[model samples]
Target: MSENELIERIKDRNPNEPEFLQAVEEVISSVSKVLKKHPEYHQLRILERMAEPERLISFRVNWLDDEGNVQVNRGFRVQMNSALGPYKGGLRFHPSVNQSILKFLAFEQIFKNALTGLPLGGGKGGSDFNPKGKSDNEIMRFCQAFMSELFRHIGHFTDVPAGDIGVGSREIGYMFGAYKKLQNDFTGVLTGKGPKWGGSAIRPEATGYGLVYFAENMLKSVDKEIKGKSCIVSGAGNVAQFTLEKLIQLGAKPVTVSDSGGFIYDEDGIDEEKLEHIKHIKNVSRGRISEYTEKYSNAEYTEVNSDDDFNPLWQTKAECVFPCATQNEINEKDAKHLTDNKIILLAEGANMPCTAEAIDVLQESKVLYSPGKASNAGGVGVSGLEMTQNRMGVYWTREEVDEKLKGIMKRIHDDCLETVETYELSDHNYMEAANIHGFLKVAEAMKAQGVV
Candidate 1:
């Protein structure tokens, strides 16, 4: 079947799964040229099989709250593909966790892992149990219960899960403890463990750091540098915090940072000291971005206005824009705002943070755009490094891990550029290059394995 036909079939099969279908359509459409060149992939129904998960494990997670009330939540693990190697991805724990979201993330993971040049395949698992507002004990109980059923399907050599969104060091610690107790063996079944417990030194910061590395490469391609570029970074979470750090390290003036509450615009730039304060506010105090204005009198904090069609966070005047927040945070209006403000570079630190219409606007404006799968693959790349370190039973120094990560990010950037030139695409379509190049690796592996 044709790519469009395959997408239509996917839509029909996955009703109400807009996220999943969107992901499949993006990849299928991006790699249409390669699919046409190699019709064997069509004959073997490669896209059809690739769109479907190998295993979809769903269960009810029951745990007691601090009030002694039994809370039940839906949990899911979508082992999307394992043709490259073992299944590897993060497990998110947010109220937004659903089959559609997980499937889309898993599908994106396939290409992301392939781009990393790692043996890891793609999979993602999570529960709809919001860790927010929950007591430590309650959160521990929930993680333990979530792992009770999840442990049966995951392992170091099978499916290695990490942390995402609401799942951080605390949550990973809880889940790792439960998995250890359940299996009665110590192994690297998880990647975001504490450093003393086998986690890599830079695992938490890899994604954000790698994003800056990718962005730097993009700027260099245009004969520009990040040193004096003004940047607006959304989301004050791990990705945003570290992205700011790296940007500052490169002498870039990152002027804004945001959370769900809204964004803070500091014209003086967010230096290392400001970033540290933000880390404490979000990671320790669990406070809102508005608290930033109290510390820095020059900064302005804007609250999220639901009636606004465009996110004010993206409207900030800047040369570089990094969307490190949740999916679809940047709508078409926001994209137009960024373009009107003369934004030169935009890269996603979060998965699919920009809507399709937003991406079109950026592309039409000739802005250098990098998709999350390639730009944010650093987190998973370091996770893959953590797996190697685990297998060797040794830890590398911080400098070593960071160096390796920089090399990987540079290689991925070059590969995407090469793919774009090879495909003769206009406007340096990194999204299409990333999708096609990433898909080719996995597709070859699947074909060699004889359609398993």
Candidate 2:
């Protein structure tokens, strides 16, 4: 069947899975022609097989709140593919957690992990329990309850899960501890552990630092440099924080960072000192991004009004932007805003942060764009390194791990550029190159493994 027909079938099957369909459509739109070039793929029904998950696990999480009341939340794990190796991905805990969202994330993970060139497959798990305002005890209870079921499914060489979105070191620790308690055995069943334990160095900052490293390579390709450039970075989480930190380390002036509450645009660039404040606020206090204005008089905080068609954060003039906030945060209007403001590049730090329409706007405007699969593969790259360290019972220094991550990002960037050259595509068409290159490995592996 044709790629469009396969997409229509997917939509018909997953009628409510908009995010998963969007992800599949984005990838199929880029790689469909490439798939057509290999008739065996169509004959073997590879596209149809890939569109479906190998395993989709869902469970109910029950925990008690501090107020002596029982609370229940839904948890999920979408083991999308294991063509290359063990199932590897993240566990996100948020109010928006659902089967469709996890499936989208897991599907994206399959390609993102492929781009990293690591022996890891793709999977994602999460729950709808929001940890934003919950106390440590409440969060711990929820994590234990969630892990009690998840433990039965994951293993070191089977499925090594990590953190994402609402899942951080704290949540990972809680879940790992619970798993260890239940199994009565210690293994590398999870990544993103604390440094004192099995976690690798620079794991927390890998995604953000790798993003900058990838961005630098892309900029250099077009005879542009990041030094002295003004940048807009969205999201105040781990990825955004480290993106800001790395930009500062490289002498770039990052002017904005945002959270769900809103965005903060500091006319004065966010320096190391201000970043410390932000880390304390979000990591310690769990406060909103708007609290930034309370300490820094020079910073202006804008509350996000849902009624607005476009986010004002992207309107700020800058040489580049990183939308690390979440998926679909940048709509077509937001992309248009950046293009109109003369934005030079956009590297995604979050999965599928840009919609299809937004991508079209940016590409038409000739903006340098790299998708999350290639740009945000750093986190998984480091997680892969951590798994290695755990297996060998050895740990690498921070500088060693960072160097490895840099090399991985550079390799992914070069892979995209080479694919562009091979396909005779546009100079900066990293999206097509990335989707094609990433999908090639998984497709071949699936073909080799036969019609399972």
The per-residue C-alpha lDDT of model 1 at residue 27 equals: 90
User: What's the TM-score of each model vs. the native?
Assistant: 0.99, 0.99
Worst 10 residues of 1 by lDDT: 306-315
Clash pairs detected, candidate 1:
none
RMSD to the true structure for each prediction, in A, is 0.9, 0.9
Query: Superposing every Cα of model 2 onto the true structure, what RMSD results?
Result: 0.9
Residue-by-residue lDDT tens digits, candidate 1, 331-384: 999999999999999999999998888999999999999999999999999999
Per-residue accuracy of model 2 over 1-452 as CA lDDT, tens digit each:
77778889999999999999999998888886687588888898877787899999989889999999999999998889999999999999889989889999999999999999999999999999999789999999999999999999999888999999999999999999999999998998999999998898999999999999999999999888899999999999999999999999999999999988789999889999999999999988888888888999889998888689999998998998999989999999989999999999999999999999999999999999999999999999999999999999999999899899999999999999999998888778999999999899999999999888
Error of 1 at 127 (Å): 0.8
lDDT value for model 1: 0.93
The count of backbone overlaps in candidate 1 is 0
Evaluate residue 328 in candidate 2 and report its C-alpha lDDT on the 0 to 100 scale.
95
